[model samples]
Target: MTAWLPLESNPDVLTKYIHKLGVSKEWEIFDVVGLEPQMLEWVPQPVKSIILLFPISETYEKHRAQEHEKLSVDPGVFPDDLFYMRQLTSNACGTVALIHSLANSKSISLEDGILKSFLENVKDLTPEERGKALENDKSFTEGHHELAKEGQTVADPEEKVNHHFVALINKNGVLYELDGRKEFPIKHGPTTDETFIQDAAKVCKEFMARDPDELRFTVMALSSV
Candidate 1:
């Protein structure tokens, strides 16, 4: 996936982290890069997927809301939705792709896929209801598109959509979409792993490197560009 990688515990932190790459452009491109602290701790070792947990605030709706429609602080941020918080998360799919490639990871890659919903995971779905949702992808795509655009759109209406904002990798390895965060229900967040399945998956991938290295980093900037 070509979406900008979310390199932190939450996606909102993108407000500052994009600058580390030395890109002179006005915005950041999402893609995979970097290892988990644990992966890096091992050094020179390649990484498995870096599980990135981005804080998705309940107040996100408030920030983009019209003045009168704005949410009240009394209620505080919207209560965190564990489902939304879980699967649909990440800085950028680009970061995922880069990391997958850099670490030589073999996996189905997509930032949105991490957030996409599947009914088997939804607790309330009647078997029929679940089947219905699975057959519909239009509403799903539109929903994700809007969310992603909310954070990537420029203040100036006429500004061209910034290419740096987001990108995606389809199951078939195609650049399927744009704006990573908008790409899912977040309710359908990434699937949880069983310890044994995770271990077996890792066994098939090469995570060991032969040496050690260090690199310095600096923050640059954030823009809707």
Candidate 2:
């Protein structure tokens, strides 16, 4: 959330890309990872959700950018915002270490759909276990909604760090926020993630066109630092 690159400086590439929002299911974002091996790996993934790192949010991204170039703005925004943005960018960046860990072992007991199915098909499970399972299911499915609530007001990802600064009413109208991502105000079109990864890869290839060195990585690196 702490990207100090005055939004006025670098044109909002996302806005431009949003204008080109045709029928493609891809993710195009600028996640800064300073010569890090992990960052380089997920560079080509389609990013449906973007936790912008421009201006630079983390210490590593900031440190690298500082060493590589002169920074004209503050890169760090806020701790809460950073944590929240991390959630959004984690999956898109193709590096979800925590998710991968939780997904296994409890694959049949705790995941989103798998657990839901288990509950639905269960005929003799303890009431407490059933309730616990239900609670976990709700938490897992509400990820997007939770993020939207925190981020919607800050149309720009960096601004998400200062959502509290936005006018309450105006904040309610922003898309990344709950008002926009929610079903009522500005419902997002139903976009299946099945093709999302493919779409992201295609877009990356298109952007890097002739640059063979920037080719997509086979492994999805979950961490940038």
Candidate 3:
């Protein structure tokens, strides 16, 4: 599988990347100072989505396995319009997460460019097929590579990246966790436009609580600039 340099969780770099990929300037990425209520207050209103970067440690892997098993028997309601795709390439989670964040956000206007075109082409494809489409799209891949290099600390493409990213969005009042590496989008219960940041923050807190000693987690929101 092809591997690209991992993207740092820097708002400026991410904002630039999304802008380059066709997301309108009306929306920009901003760091979530903390998961607490006080910190969420600093984030701009009408947050479109939240992206989380966390370590892919044994603890996370184990929990993911357990969660998958439990959800397999009782998968909750999946919105037919939910946009999700699998991550087929190594180190592509950041880009996948960004795509998930933007694609599902109907409120965010997309320009006629790489991301907009890619999403439209894959709108009717299965999740796996969407992943394949992304892998084969030269324009999208080139854009990702170009922006990945702008990170503060770019890692070698061949090096193993221990961290992964996931996007959270409120889709029709339900909060969903969209991780391309996962088999399916995980439902995180109900949420509203006004409470999306707080709801996502709760989930982020849960992730931190699972691995108390790990401190590599980062959170950011896509909101009005």
Q: TM-score ranking from best to worst? A: 3, 1, 2
Tens digits of per-residue lDDT, candidate 2, 148-196, equal 3333243343443311100001111121211111111111222333333
List lDDT for all candidates, in order: 0.27, 0.26, 0.91
Could you give candidate 3's per-residue lDDT for residues 28-139 as a string of tens digits? 9999988889889999988989999999989899999999899888877688889999999888999999999999988888889999899889999999999989889999
RMSD for all candidates, in order, please: 19.2, 18.8, 0.9
Worst 10 residues of 1 by lDDT: 210-219
Clashing pairs in 3: none
* lDDT tens readout by residue for model 1, 74-151: 322221221111113222333322222211222322232322233224436432343244334344333333333445
Q: Over the full model, what C-alpha lDDT does candidate 1 score relative to the true structure?
A: 0.27
Q: lDDT rank, highest first?
A: 3, 1, 2
> Candidate 3 has what TM-score?
0.97
Judge candidate 2 at residue 171 and give its lDDT.
Answer: 15
The alpha-carbon deviation from the true structure for residue 191 of candidate 3, after best TM-score superposition, in angstroms, is: 0.7
